[model samples]
Target: MRDLSPPAPRARGALGVAAAVLMAAATLAAPAHAAAAPAGGTAEAAVTAPAPPMGFTNRDSTRCRAEFDEAYVKKIADILVAKGLKDAGYTYVNLDDCWARPARDDQGRLVPDPVRFPNGIKALADHVHAKGLKFGLLAGAGARTCDPAGFPGSLGHEAGDARQFADWGVDHLTYADCGGGGDAEQRYAAMSDALRATGRPVVLTVADQGANRSWEWDGDVAQVRRTTGAGTDGWGSVLARVKQNLPLAAHTGPGRWNDPDALHVGGYGMTETQYRTQFSLWSVMAAPLVIGSDLRKLDAVSAEILTNREVIAVDQDPRGKPGEVVASDAGRWVISKELADGSRAVALFNETNRPRHIATTAGAVGLPAASGYKARDLWTALEKGTSGTIAATVPAHGTVLLKVSADREWSQLPPLLDTTISGDAVARPGTTQRVASAVTNHGGAATGTVTLTLTGGDGWTAQPVTAASTDRLKAGATLGTEWDVTVPAGATGRHELTLTTKYRSRDGLTFTSAIPVPVLVGVTRPPAGESYLGDQAPLAATNGWGPVEKDLSNGESNAGDGSPITINGTVFAKGLGVNSPSSVEYYTAGRCTRVTAQVGLDDEAGTQGTVTFEIWADHQQVASIPKMTNADAARSLTADVSTAETVRLVVTDGGDGAAYDHADWADLKITCA
Candidate 1:
């Protein structure tokens, strides 16, 4: 097995070296191409790249389907107009997966199911374009669509498929796992190249499912990449996707954005508050605001969520910076984005099961109270004045989205710490405790030789465990270290542990954490033969035992043979045969010992019954009251056994007739003294 421990400094350096070598190899294999020349003979140039077709939009039927009909299509056009989505810059109405048919026609062209799309894709695109919108389509990278055995895949048929989509007026195309083919990047590039050759400026949306960290490099090949799975309307799903995509914010741009799948707002399985929270998060993340609900049937709350201009502004901001989490805890979180106008858009989210008051000072978010700010609650449509700081009572799984501008002038505020720290703690014997601290440097400049002191309790000693020698933390990076300290052993009640970090320019800050370590005097074990035993049967139900006899013949049983069992339980056979050639055995946990049993026909064995027995703690098997077995009779035979440590038990079939040589067990039990 590979070592799971964190890599040493030398090993990390070596990994960087290996990455450089791999990049060099890739560069050599495929020489970088030059950008196409611009129309004017100036030094500037234009770049031509493979992209998704123009009119594609991702759709989810579980939430809403982009069905093709005059009424439905017109309704979507109207909703887009009413919401001003078109004005804000959303155009294509792309159909995601699950919209295709099972087979293609003899002409090798995909056939849209007439029942769902009677006017066909072309008519739908025409209608959308007439309304100033575009139509897009979806297909799988594998042989079959997301559907089991659906339409033919777009693997080797990339060129033909591109032409087909072009002919159908497809403006955008979303491809997933393409034909489930070659390397993810290579396959995506191939499809993009194929689409580009079709003389159509189709916008290519590569759905890599975020596998292999493709979002980090896919920007060069596709217009956008899905950074997470298909989205759900649930708040948990939205929060999870947002947190996962935050690291990829640096990769987003005008032509490419990190898609947190689609908008689940106003969809099923979400409350009004949740929908608002979802919209706020997606907008802050700069994710595509592709609505995934029945636009015509939207409720009032859904309409409000989808049309919030302030929230939408953060998403459609020209700067295109994805928001990053600035503060996060069990109940609250804060994410911030740098806007193009030298301002910041901050979102304070409350994701607990209940309402919470999430507060953050201006300094915490890198803002000065001297710069008076205006806070707008996106969900409530209310505006509040702030004196360089903001705080609010956010509902459960809800948020307060704000736009903080530094244009306002106010009195200067005291200097404060810009760094934040988070960590976990564990208890140890004596007066010592172990704590791991993750220090985040949010300041513009790097910090050096910082000291973290632990105070309080009767006696406390702090010693750095890791990252101490360097004593430097770089800007925008986090440094983790452990500290071992001694606290009075007799301390029983909660005591405060203060962390103080000193820097020259920045003010020294103190953060207090309460720690309670209970004292344990002694440990005890259960009395002999009364200890609990852990045992479980295998999950599979089958006819043959492993590596043992394929089939049991005559009056023989396949019990315990070749199987491991805990000897804690009573060993038994459901249906046992006397005078049969059948037996089974099991190995103990340590494999130190084996137990076996055999039943033989007695001279006076006239009646058909069962033979019961028990095993004692001394590893001795004892016969209990004897029971009779009649001719062609089936009966259960059980035996209880005990051992010093733990052991295994085996039961064998001893019977006369071949038909009576089997025993079946419905249940087994283990009893402690």
Candidate 2:
């Protein structure tokens, strides 16, 4: 006989008293067995014996049973034993439903597909038992097995099926909710009672379709109850299920556990680290460690992560307390567990797309650090001092699990509310309106009779902002309220809307929000200017132009009669210097043939200084001079030119470095009628 001593308890430290109180409350609230039975009458009970203390193999019987040859059954049993499941406190290898043929034999008995299990189910059970493991079978709570195509069901023959399992040397049974049964709790209890009536200790695993609210009803009638749906062998699916189980932790205990479906650690689509995280969370939650992956084909890393004793201890802790989420956002979560010993297990998880720094302090978790502390990183096998805080960098979609132990006595912190302003609110002109403000409570307790006041707003009259109702603002909760105010007509500027909240503190500690309300009044319009050609206009000019092109000179010429004229040029080749000029000079001419000119240039490279040029024209429009380009090469250049009866030109350097050297041109022509 093997010694199956109960798992060891966790070390003691802080958080012990509160955790114990909560655990006691949960035990008291657990449902009684009799409450699980179907209402108003007992049907014939099943005769299946309770499962033994041995791990089992579960397979989809309907599809593969015909191919379930002796070689396959032996291979499965070998893998289960090799994984040391029996030695690690697991038994009852179960075969999932759909193992039977469409119809029963003439004797009205469920028959295994002859070709799949040629030697029969009983023979398969014998083979499993010979390998030091238990064999279990599946059935549905509905009238028929899940074979919707028409197969046998346990609906009216619960007891008869139990008897069949008992006679076949079956040690356990997994009852799934199929065919849309009414009241899953009732159905589960019926099957449990029927199986127990056979005078066997058959381990009963129930699938409640994630709707049984098992936390409110499960007791001794079920050793384990499905609280969520079946899972895939992917990190996302695994993490989702883990989060779902967080709230359900209060319902798990000795001889009863929250079934987060089954394990997929070594299965398809999961990385080694992901599998480690999955196994770690499951163990911490004290969930049943059922294997869903193929053990025979598992890699060494998968096997090692699944079997770490230190991490496993957290899961199998005798206290059986479930962890809860302390904080979560953007794929990052902080979870804490109350251990049997006084310490708490804190896990900081980064489920984001990138690595992130996560930190948690005893004060943040409402734990006292007066006693000092130590943190042991379970994944890395490293220890650190956590006198009052625990912090670490978590990889993308990874986690940091630490055990915090305090040496002195401390009390949980009182709840608090932290307020922040999201951004400035804009109020439209000519209307009195209520603008909503957001407030979040980060405290440990609820706040009552909270009042908010609008301090002041220049040029604006403040009105009362109404809340949905007055109630206690609980910790970790958020609420929104609007401020009513009138923006006077023709108000065309910005204003500050200040607000403050008043509340009495039950714990003798007052909390206040640090941010102030900044509101903008009146609409913001673009400056008065000609609307440019682009969709956005003047804004486009500043943003659209590429790098300046050097060694290029260009400008627009004007007519002498004060009218604008166009200048034409033909480019011979592209150059590497600045090709565009920033500003254009305008000139005027007074005569019938007046000419106007604006010089523009496109500079690709920024190497350019002041380039000098000379211009000649009549007296109405004179000869003009061009200076050196600015240090910053011009992207576009334009110059306004005008014509006159007589004109003279002079050119001088403006201290700019590079000249317009690429394409040389001499004649300047301006158009005037």
Candidate lDDT values, in order: 0.51, 0.52
Quote the RMSD, in angstroms, for model 1.
20.0
Whole-structure CA lDDT of model 2:
0.52
Each candidate's TM vs. the true structure?
Answer: 0.53, 0.52
Over 1-673, each residue of candidate 1 has an lDDT whose tens digit, in order, gives 1111222222223453343234223322221122222112122211211111111133553323445444565567767777766654556677666555676788777777676677777777677777777666787776666654456677767767877777777766778774466677666666666665555555577776575466655554566787765554455456556656777777665556677677766667678777877878878887777777666567777766676767777786755567877887754888887777766788888865434556676656666445455555565554433455555556556777887655342212111122233332223335565666544443334555555554555565667777632355554456566877675655442244555555332233322222222222111212333222213221111121111222121122234342221111223332122222122222122212222233222212324323222222223443322332433222333344433333222222221112221223222333433
Native-to-model Cα distance after best TM-score fit, residue 474 in candidate 1, in Å:
39
- The digit string of per-residue lDDT tens for model 2 on 55-161 reads 43444222344444556667777766687555564555677755677777887778876766778888888887777677778777776666556567677677777
> What is the overall TM-score of model 2 with all chains considered together?
0.52
